[model samples]
Target: MTSFGIWGLIPPVLTITLAFITKDVMVSLFLGIFSGALIVAGGNPLVAIINLTDMVAGSLNDGWNIRIFLFCALLGGLVGMLSKTGSAHAFGRWAADKLHTQKTSLLMTWFCGLLIFIDDYFNSLAVGTVMRPITDKNKVSRAQLAYILDSTAAPVCILVPISSWVITVMSIVKGSEGFDALGVSEFSFFIRSVPYNLYALLTIIMVLVIILSGRNFGPMAKSIAYAQETGNLYNEKYGPAPGEIDIDGDVNADKAKPLDMLFPIIVLIVSAVILFPVTTYLSSIDGETITSVGAAAASMSLGDAFNNTDASMALFYAVIFTLVITYIYYTVRKLFTIKEASGAITDGIKSMVPALIILTMAWTIGTVIKNSPADGGLGLAAYLSDAVVGGGFPIALVPVIAFALSALISFSTGTSWGTFAIMIPIVMPIAVGLAQAKGLADAGLLNAAMISVSAVLGGSVFGDHASPISDTTILSSTGAGCPHLEHVATQMPYAITTAVCALVGFFVGGIFLNVLAAWIVTLACFAAAMVFLPKILNN
Candidate 1:
């Protein structure tokens, strides 16, 4: 790392500010990357441009990065194929007739997101793809649909014990020595933190409040109102246009069966169920083959199995399984000519180009901050940990401050997992030290540590929901066929509302050493914000 120092913060700050002002995600991200390169290149404009290319190349070439990109792209093709076979329209018509109201449509989407708890990526793309048509027909805006897709994604994943998120968090926390002092398992500690993870809990709460109340505000309100009034679900400013998620122009709607959509989705879910364990067993293998489920479970604890699993690779496998099955099913039923299927696949991959570009740029900018000699990257994290310690903030407020720090970094980086990589290591050690020094009881110390971990997780997800360049954000837009910037505009008010409540909840939780009370107040705050803020903002 170079000696760039505090200047590393410039890129993300600049990106957010510019994106808000420009409403142009692509240029905002590129400029953010360029700014980081400029600082890292010692202000030499030419060198910075050259550094930009290298940084982008490095990010795209990364194995994990490429894996996620391919997964999104391949899944995009599946969506396109669904539309091409006229399954989306048939399904939408059928869903519209059944749901009969906008509230049910949105709630159904939210419920689906909650059910797909195995992985966040799966939750996002799958929910968006499946629900877009239904929601659109019921007069729900793409922005609103994207909001539900994103809100329920990482937030739901983090809460579920069997998810990749839980497995990862457990692995990291278990490695910390603090839990030894408390005499609790990492999984147990994480479970206790659930009530205290204000943002995640409140986000889901806010979604329900918005849906059940049948009220919305800000850009989202306008979008929903417009859709209801005009039967035009897309706002032109925030997207490439809304019909891309629709049927091919030449398709015969009558030929499309709802099963054309349901069958593949079912296959994808099954593949994920099968692959999660197989991936775990394989990754956990030292030198021997795992011949049976019983043997695999015996060899590793559930948490350990998940920790060892490669979620990205496993997702890749799921997408491939879905694509192969979907295409073959279509061709076998004579629903698609070989040429039509091939074209749909090509267009589907093409549709993901915007998201892929944003993901690459976001990844590059993250590297600029982390790897740069300046204080903005890894150095920034270290510096902040020291600053937080050195600051005279009370022990009870550590969770609040940690939440803020995690949010900033994740927002800047556009990756919650990356935020976890940086913030968890810092917070874990701090928790152990603080807990030991306070001479706190086991429950008290556990409470403090849980707050800290939960803060990081909640804040990372909130920030990811807010960030324009975020992968889930892009995918949500792609799935809903909304404009990328429009999704950001509509989503920010909701995310920030939950975040403000969560921040207050953390402080209250710390003060009273009670999680349940904090959750009640947090959800209440979200409810008030939803009812009043929209009215105030609309006025």
Candidate 2:
């Protein structure tokens, strides 16, 4: 009903601009939400404030959003437990001795992120908690550490077949006629799409380029220089004062063993993995009311198990289990009293307060912008994208456009999963129609569908990586104990460079429709960009 159309982009634009100006993300998000409410309420200031309050409260009511908030709190407590037990310190000391250089320290962090491929939330918090001390000793700026943590979080998750991202995408792709007509399973389609996901691939690879080359251009370079030269891990302008970000555990380090920390973390990870199936199985049982265990097990493979899996519940229950395990183990070891364990949980959850607030604000603005059409809010973005695709946008350019559009939406909204939800339905049907109109072979049509899917996944991840308001981005900064704005400003340059290279890859792939040819050329393009862009930017 609000016919703002393309003009509806103003709210997000204002939000981003205000963040840089005010240097306060909360105020910026509030202003952005108010701007949208103003448009919806036809410029009535009082009604706009009312609308703002309602929508923000509504964002909290959504189950997915609440789950994320609770998850972050639990993850914070876990990190605190590790810190208090001196687990992170022991590992940090061991790693620092083995790594002995900035590049190696960074690589260790990246590898840890990659290893935790099950979920992005786990990846960001876990890697940051474990690697923070090593990176700090190696003179890596918290911003650089934040960038590494973020780049690996979503990008690595998207690239793997066995991750939360894959499950989400498969659910979207399962109902798509484009993928269905191709005569392949949704999971296979997702796997096929991985190679074409240029944004994700480039992002993962670029971390190495930044590390090995040591050509840190842009704000990141300045940050690293300041840290390496002065032994200061954070800059004065964007970084918090030294003591403000500290969440170190409150216990003596003399008696702490690495196992005190490692045991609980291991339980948490394994429990999460096992419970994914257990949770899904229980749901299926409730829905089907099956008496036969064999029948229930068979039905689980309809590929709906992942969809049925309650990720939040599983995570919550798993972490709780780990805490129980930790409490017992630490008690037996006489490392800390029961009171101390409770204190660590309290301290950890407290540390995550800033991140939770930022995430909630970001989600509120996203709700205002992406509310359903029937809700009578600003739904202009989808309309704007529809116009481009429907106005005879070329078939060859579909993947490229899909990638770019998805990136823009995800960037503005600060949620990759939300971006995927919006783009998958829009782009897939177009990809199919284009292929059919061109009289493509079965293989070619399938290829086209896969390309479109890949574009959406890649673009969403890329945009989320760059967006300051993104949950993963916030988590990365929080985990690194870096000032969030500095993390955003420093990583923007690196994310943008990889995204540019990926754009070219999508464009070329769209033009030719040959996966091998496009991949070869794109890798070359990425290498060239990585080699030359730094010199160009440095100059």
**lDDT tens digits by residue: candidate 2, 1-539:** 53467656777667657755664556766787788888888889999999888887876787655765676677667656665666555555666678878889999988777766655765777678778878877778998889999999999978865444655566556534345567665645776677888888888888877888887888888888789788888887885732323334566666765555467757777887777667667656654567554567677683566545666566667767876777778778776778988888788788777656656665565555555436746764455445545676677798888888888767876767655655675577678777766788688888888887788888889877889878899989888879888899889988988887777878888888877766787788777876787678767
RMSD of 2: 6.6
Instruction: State TM-scores per candidate.
Output: 0.65, 0.66
Runs in model 1 deviating more than 4 A are 1-3, 13-17, 20-52, 96-197, 207-248, 288-297, 372-378, 392-500, 509-518, 526-539
Clashing pairs in 2: none
lDDT of 1 by residue, 136-165 (tens): 667788888989998888889889764545
Lowest summed lDDT over 10 consecutive residues: which window, candidate 2?
241-250
List per-prediction Cα lDDT, in the order shown: 0.72, 0.73
Could you give me the TM-score of model 2 versus the true structure? Answer: 0.66
